[model samples]
Target: MSTITYYLDMQRPEQIIGKPLPADLSVVECQHKQYQLNRFLYQLVGEPWQWTDKLSWSDAQWRALIEQPGHRTWVAYYQGAVAGYYELLRDAEGVVEILYFGLAEAFFGQGFGGPLLTQALQSAWAWPGTTRVWVHTCSLDHPSALANYQARGLRIYREEVEAEAP
Candidate 1:
């Protein structure tokens, strides 16, 4: 199989289109490092999309990745239930990368992706010294993934196709 990966970036905060969260939905940062919760979320939101890179991550690996100084996670709650999540990491040069972003299987098609992504971008830009915010999505992701990113003002910076084992 061939997987197409698109790299997107926002050079300024004003670039974001800004979608407001619905009255019944809210996004909050996971202030404390919790590898277990992060692992669960990674599995929960990424299973259908073939997100296997972190599936084999040991507890210490997960902790080291998430417990770093510039890493952050945000979760979206729909009426108090876990709806979706995104993770952001800022590099030394002030670039914040949205490492992972997705909604749960149950939350699809309910108009959550846009607003959730907006919040993610806002959070990314809000980080101190942020010069750029970026993310990558592949063809394996939800069909709306690329559209949502573009609609939110992230411009394509690069694209590549890779062979994947079936």
Candidate 2:
């Protein structure tokens, strides 16, 4: 199988500003919980990336990744259950990357994605000296992924097609 991936970027501070969080939604910073992080990723990304192979990372690797400096993960709660989450990484050069962002399959289309993304962008922009914020999405991602980014003012800067092993 093959997929087309779009690389989107936002360099100006204006682009990173996002709407306020909805009344019932709240975001909590996840801390030192590799198992919970991995489980959340699997639940949110497993369906969209089904054509690709499953993720296989040891617990230690997961811990290392999550514990790295400048790496931040936020989980969204809707009246108490896990609804969605996003991870942000800020490099020394002041570039903030939205490494992963998604709503759980069960929470899709219930007005969660936008607010989640808004909070993610807001968090990214809050970092001192942050000059760029970016993320990548593929054809294999949710159908609304591309549109949502565009709607939030991220511009498509590059795109490419690649084959995926079955």
Global lDDT of model 2: 0.81
Among residues 3 or more apart in sequence or in different chains, the pairs in candidate 2 whose N, CA or C atoms overlap within 3 Å are none
Give residue 39's lDDT in candidate 1 (0 to 100).
97
* Local accuracy of candidate 1 as per-residue lDDT tens digits, 1-166: 8989999999999999988999999888999889899999999999999889989989999999999999999999998889999999999999999999999999999999999999999999888899999999989899999999999999999999998877
lDDT by residue for model 2 over 67-108, one digit each (tens)? 788888888988888788888988999999998888878788
State the C-alpha lDDT per candidate: 0.95, 0.81
| Each candidate's clash count | 0, 0
Over all chains combined, what TM-score does candidate 1 have? Answer: 0.97
Which candidate's TM-score is highest? Answer: 1
RMSD of each: 1.2, 2.4
lDDT of 1: 0.95
In candidate 1, stretches whose alpha carbon ends up further than 4 angstroms from where it belongs are: 164-166
